[model samples]
Target: MAGAAELFVWWVLAVVLQVFLTGPLSWLEWTVAAGAAVPAAFGARAVRRASGAGSGGGARALHAVLVWPVALVADTGRLASLTLRALRGRQVRGRFQTLELGRGTGAAWACTLLSATPGAYAVGLGRGRFVLVHTLPGPPGVLADALTDGRRS
Candidate 1:
């Protein structure tokens, strides 16, 4: 089954990560990783199914993993610069804006990405097509730019 295959992949990944992090896995560690991987994989599968996201979910998830950290770092630096500028008596403005995301899963993904970054907070969802976000007076359209570009670049 697809779930079994997914679990096996996760199990292998866990084992590999354990080896990389702790430098070689004991039998007990292997057992623990195997046990943990099964439940985690199942939970992940459930979430993916519940989200009803389309077929490219894996690619999107991978892309997010690869680019999110870079974006987070960039956004944090930008936020700090803006904060310092504000402290120097420059005007800083924040606004609550609604964006049309066009799909439920897309909106959810966008919201999640926005909230995880430093300068943005995804506050609400509306009618399965819009997301409300607050940007903390940095460059506008961080979320919009990320979504449109399909990467944090």
Candidate 2:
């Protein structure tokens, strides 16, 4: 099932790219696209299986698409501001701290989302489901607060 999903996604992307880069897709172009997509899709499926992430790849992908863009833009703005401040010779102190993320899949999801935010990275999981993260100089709770704040809404 995952392989089929990956194959479909890649083929769609290839067709779009081919059309944009060249022109309307010819039968030859489509055959070439399918040939290329097959191996890539299988490779992706293999990796996904190895990762042991829960099923429903399509849902996870959809959730990411819905939530990521706004979060990314906000994080980018914050990171740029911090960078400008540092360039002005202001002293900055970054630190590592552990945040209490509840157990199970939600914790895993939160850790991944926090890691993707700018100016922060989840180093690893800590004792009791805590997520150890490093962040640019700011309140120790900044990232944690951001994560929880999003949850409330």
Candidate 3:
């Protein structure tokens, strides 16, 4: 079941990415996107199984899905600002912030969502609630707050 879900999700996302990032696409491009999604999807499933994160979650996964769109846009804009600054001979200031993380599958999902954005990458998960994230310096975005689990240490 998880494998099916992964495959479906991957296929959908790949198609969407190709369509959005490349503008108008030909049938061959669509086929390539779909063909590429299969192996990636299975690989994700295999990793999840090996890591014991296949247990998944309920509302938490839904929440991450909801938070994703907002975070993606905000992070992209932040990276763009950083790029503009760099181009104008200004220093690009990226920083690391430790954010609170949940346990088990929740932690994995949170990290995945946080890392998907351009401005932030979930660098490592330390002992306990330490999720080290490298991101462009800015006010905490909605995703960080969502993943923080309302506990700031």
Question: For all candidates, what are the clash counts?
Answer: 0, 0, 0
Residue 92, candidate 3: C-alpha displacement in angstroms: 4.3
Better of 1 and 2 by lDDT: 1
In candidate 2, stretches whose alpha carbon ends up further than 4 angstroms from where it belongs are 1-65, 106-109, 139-153
Best by TM-score: 3
TM-score attained by model 1: 0.56
Relative to the true structure, candidate 2 reaches a TM of 0.51
The estimated TM-scores of all candidates read 0.56, 0.51, 0.76
The list of candidate 1 runs beyond 4 A from truth reads 1-61, 102-105, 141-143, 148-153
TM-score of 3: 0.76
lDDT digits (tens) for residues 1-153 of candidate 3: 856777677567667767868898789988887788777767766665675544355666677778878889988888888899899999878788888764433566577778888867888877766778887787777777776765543
Better of 1 and 2 by TM-score: 1
Query: 68, model 2: CA deviation in Å?
Result: 2.9
Q: Candidate 1, after superposition: displacement of residue 98 in Å?
A: 1.9
Q: Give the higher-lDDT candidate: 2 or 3.
A: 3
Residue 21 in candidate 3 has what lDDT? 81
Which stretches of candidate 3 lie above 4 Å from their native place?
Answer: 86-92, 103-105
